[model samples]
Target chain A: MLRRFGLVCVFVSFATLPAHAESVRITQDIEARTITLNGAEIVIDRIQDSENRLEGDFARTSRPCPPFCITPMTVAPGVVTLGELEVMDFLDASVAAGEGLLLDSRLPEFFAKGTIPGAINLPFATLDPANPYRDEILKALGATLTGSDWDFSEARQLAIFCNGPWCDQAPLAIRYLLQSGYPAEKLSYYRGGMQVWLQLGLSTHTPSGG
Target chain B: MSATARVTTTLNAPPDYLGGNMFLASSRRLPEISMLRALAIASLFAGITVALVLFKADPGAPPAAEGANVTRSSAGFDNLAITPTAAVPQVAQSVPQAGPRIQDQGHVASLPAVAADVDLQAMTRGVLAELGVTPPAPPPTDTGADDPLHAMSMAALSGLRKMTGQPDPAQSPSAFQTLIAQALQAGQSDAYIDALLNEAAGSGRITVPSALVTAEGRVDTHVILSTIVAQAAIASGQDIGAAKVSSSGRIQPGQQQVYTVSAGDSLGSIALRFYGDMSRYNTIFDANRTVLSSPDSLRVGQRLVIPTI
Candidate 1:
């Protein structure tokens, strides 16, 4: 009976082995089709390979200067730069628990195409002090007005990114937000953004009504 | 192997009713003649059965089945069967017999009458009438455009006065000299005003004095020249759609200019300030297509390249 049981164990082990020997192995243990974000299941998967020969703008090798230049590593003093795994962790742990927000600071044109899951577009210019709509935007971000003074006690932590490290839209947004009294410790910068996210074969989804 | 060869082999080979024992043990023959007769009859039946099996198993049978579908009811198949050797020559003969001579005799004389019956103009007019669309009227010709002074009106002079921020007068100017005096009084240079008058005159507006039209070397002011540049742009057939006056009034014609987008700014408004026509915003959009994907969304502090048209 013991011998039979051993034989069955060997057979099961052989059966469970993968078909391809050279397939890549991921370091992170993320195997689920969707992840929890803000108490909802957000799907995480790479873009499918298109049959057509044409490529998209994010897939391009280069873009114009002034707007698409690479940014510095440190945006603010206490703000920490994040990678894909760290960003995902932020979304899964902080954002899902209602302690954080993910901001895609690109203009609506780029944001409308596709973005990282769980990201909301708050264009960089909207946070400018000179912007006429700054107060309205600040109010919408959960800032409360008390006797002509703004309070940021209940404001969630923000994770901002744009087209990638090369794009300044998000950095400008981070600077503006920092100037507007958002705590630097509460801001996480996803510097890799959509470019590196797509390069690494990560998933993205278009937001509703984007 | 060929179908005929396979059939022949099945006929000659002995059937295996008793397995290989029939051939091997045949030398130990049966003693009675009746036994030999029975064996001979059995062998004959077996040979016929084997032959039918071989024929069914033949590979060449499928092509014959396909040919059956093709010639199931051909018109000339029966006739071809009666004279098989002449079939190819007869088919070849039928083709050229329906040659060019037959086509010419049948079709040539009938084509011109068909062509003559079609009237393209009448057909087009009939189609137009059926659609209930009338032909557009011809544009009117103006013979008085050569006389620039004849087109002067108080309304145009008043419009110019309003553009320069001057109040409408109780009695507006009806002639070119009075209008020029009002423009000069509103802080416009003589040369700049003279250029605008020439542009208006060229567009069949009031004629200016010959001396003003021929004058040169007047002092240039950035403020006055830029305003005249904008106004002359409109008179020179540009549609300067509602654009606010720029804070820095400098005209940089035929040169590259960079404009930072401000709040509530659009390609139309920007084009109106620089090129003096909202429709020419495409010039800005085309120049900035490398950075901007659409002309509708302009971010604040986004610098756009403006190419002069």
Candidate 2:
């Protein structure tokens, strides 16, 4: 009896609340509240705490234009732009199934502090052509190598993000991938990123130190 | 150095144009001296190359293999050396040169993962073969082992595969495997678990019966979790390890959950158990304000309202 109930309990976690308590939903129709990202089940929904203040690096309102410029609707040609719900869906499906990756394009230091639960830290600088090990990173994304040229026929679906909509790091990383011959069809851009993620009170997990 | 010195000496003199005023002569004759010197050195180098070409024996004369492939130019990337060459096929003129890349003014565009499976090393050598190096091929250099490029390429695939928590397909699913999967699903990292196990071993709480790494070079999470569960079972001292341990974090159909406080019970620990997050202790405190006096005060056998977060 416990085993069968345990299996059902594994699915999601938004059942009990008082009459006055408001339920946070990702979408009106759908609520796969807890999702498997990377390898763990994380509460992707809003934190139930109403008093939780937006604090730390994510709380800051503005940054300078040159480095932290606003990104476009689409990151690169043929690269699909996704919102928070789409990101959650991708995390629950493709990423969970190992057919896709949710990449956090921030530097390791920024990523280490906290990030979207399922995102792996693939720094934007590492994707640059200047990096000698760039081919290795592309291969990690499931691109097969035939000598020095990359073969992305079996490349994983990659959805990338940096700090937020104003950050160009993810866009730059996307450009680097294209330079290395990565197909734009397999790429996705999560434009809102961490800033919006915090605004919605979404849970963030600190990745283990490398 | 010897050849350059000889070339410079041979071009030391100047025509009788500028008068032998030291400053005027020095400035006027400098360009003429360098140009003449360059010509002399070029001839010397040309003679040496002619000698090498004439005398160098044919070792690996194989060019018929790459006669079919086209040599095209790839632009923008600096380290990548895909140069265009002539003399491969006659229809090569039909292949157009690549155009310039679109520059992002606001620096707001992205790139993609192209699936070009062309052999770059073979193509590089093919370019050489097209460049009249059909007589002798140089020795091959292998840059495989300890290569940072290779490591970065495989990190995502390996890291994601491990994250999946699914064992290799060859292995049959077991109960212990299920236990390990649950532990990974709990969200703490392998390094964290390793530290926990190390601490437990140091404290003499659990026996380190086996190595954490398996013979296949995979981290044996199976061994680690099994030890932890067994230790917890022994420490708890109950039937099947404890009095039916289950998470209170599960979604309930009811609006509230009531739990009688047990031994060693605290609001923080209860909050962690009920919500899967210890920091939400105030949620419980605020919910059960009528019953509990403060965050720290919790009496035995008190019914606490565990609110869903």
Error of 2 at A110 (Å): 1.2
Task: Please report, as a residue range, the 10-residue window in candidate 2 chain A with the lowest summed lDDT.
Answer: A11-20
The DockQ assigned to candidate 2 is 0.07
TM-score for predicted model 1 compared with the true structure: 0.36
Cα distance off (Å), candidate 1, residue B143: 42
* Model 2 spans with C-alpha error above 4 angstroms: A1-18, A30-32, A37-39, B1-161, B164-309
| Each prediction's whole-model lDDT (CA) | 0.47, 0.50
Tens-digit lDDT track for model 2 on A96-207? 7878888998876787888988888787877877554455456557777542356789888989998898899999999998888899998999999988888888878897
The lowest-lDDT stretch of 10 consecutive residues in candidate 1 chain B is: B211-220
- In model 2 chain B, which range of ten residues has the least summed lDDT? B82-91
Segments of candidate 1 deviating more than 4 angstroms: A1-28, A47-54, B1-309
lDDT of 1 by residue, B34-136 (tens): 2322343354345445655665889655543332121113222121111112122221222112121111122112111111111111222222222222311
Candidate 2 lDDT tens digits, B135-155: 122211122332443334334
